[model samples]
Target: MLGTASPTRAWLLVEEPGPWGAGGVPESRLGPEVTESLRRTASALSARLLLVRRPGQAREDDGVRTLFRVTCTRGRERVLVRTCAAADVAAAAADDDGWTERPGNLLLVCTHGRKDWCCALRGRPVAQALAALAPDDVWECSHLGGDRFAASVLTLPTGWTYGRVDATDAVDLVAATAAGRVLPALARGRCSEAMVAQAADVHARLALGVDDVAALRPVAARRDGEDEALWHVDLADAPASAAPGGVLRVTVRRTAGSEAALLTCGAAQEQHPPAWDLVALVARQLPAG
Candidate 1:
């Protein structure tokens, strides 16, 4: 997988795996159904997703660069897209039939290009660790974080983006997301609007200094003084509060089984508004915490 998906030009599209396609995203990340979920994620944030080469396939774009095209689907319906990334062609090997590939090969990206501090320095280790853990799936990106986050790891099979991830969180994240778990809270930052909401809710709970954050979202905030990012989530029918008989009685472990950062915060909402950020804020006022 590594050999074919060139790290230099591979454009990894990190977004929330959708439940078919409400703007193309899932209601809640599939956790218990890790083995059964297969989402068709898109490069929502970008106008065009970078296409990697198909395993054993290649093409030239106006003679300047080689491109690859491939398709994957949630079920029988397949989504079509392309990438000028040469490595994408080989990323095909990362594909699995489902059950056996929990944590399907990973593609950890450490590029912080989205942020002003996104230098090769921060992205280097993220790339190295991902490569070391899932060499076949890992690809040191050219600053994909698109933010100042120290590190960001996105799972290839699940399209879940665990932000503020540290070298330590790698193992658990790789295992959980690889298995298709819906890591509640932590500002999901998966680039998937839904996931981002999840992350913010979790962060909001942390900020208010409460743990009973039932279906919370950051909405928007000025992080410890970093870029203004956004966060969102939907425990819509959550319990009135984290109390008995409450609609939601949730206990989310922001950290993955591996104990890494999973530091999902309102990283995105801090900078911009998400699809449901406004709704989340209004809901937050209801005193659900």
Candidate 2:
């Protein structure tokens, strides 16, 4: 449960009304060929493939109205394909003309039971709780890469991933999303950046106490050594109280996990997962204006 699940850079979501099996989307109604193809496509793009269902009764002609939504930092792409066929998915995911720059937000809760029981048990309640608060903005989504972090939450349009969340955390999460801030305590990382960058972003957020989602943006990164990296983050449109010429330098290194355990309950005990630790944090002061 201590492993980082923040490596994804993009996400491909397919609408599937189910009866999803124990393995979730992979074993869902979408045939094995299409599922496998999706897995490969996602891997090629460093993205995560997920199955999503809008809240309500399962559609009778689910396959005919399947929706494919691709979200990346560059833009949000969507297409409505008539079938759950693999070829269609490939074309849609690859189609550049279909992508558009639009501002929208969505809360995706991981409730993929087939991937791990904990996700379903822990995530469903949180999803329901959040959905009650923002009915149109929330959806029960498939595996989000962290089975150990059962109640994993992904905030889209920004792709901020949070894990180990509970029903009680819904209010804060919703508020944070609406206000363009992130809760550092549960934040796994931002999907758009590398793990090192993700750590650096969190460090900067804590040091500056800047919660506005658009406040800090990674401008550059450099390697300090094999295990460490320095990230240059620029603060945009910061409040006057934030200080002059806003910029923050964050250094992060890989650290040891507190202990080793299977990342998921269903996984064999032989598997070990690494924990996230902050190695260093420093604020770079700017010259007076």
Top candidate when judged by lDDT against the true structure:
2
Model 2 Cα RMSD, 1 decimal: 4.3
Tell me the alpha-carbon RMSD of every candidate. Answer: 14.8, 4.3
lDDT of all predictions, in order shown?
0.35, 0.68
Error of 1 at 280 (Å): 10
Candidate 1 Cα outliers beyond 4 Å, as residue runs: 1-47, 51-105, 112-119, 143-146, 182-187, 194-196, 199-289
Prediction 2 global C-alpha lDDT:
0.68
lDDT of 2 by residue, 17-135 (tens): 66577664557766787778777776776667888766544556534424345454633432223334433765555454555443456889988887788888898889888888888
Model 1 TM-score (2 dp) = 0.41
lDDT of 2 at 44: 76
- In terms of TM-score, the best-performing candidate is 2
TM-score of each: 0.41, 0.77
Per-residue accuracy of model 1 over 127-182 as CA lDDT, tens digit each = 66655666655644323433434565544433444555566665665565455443
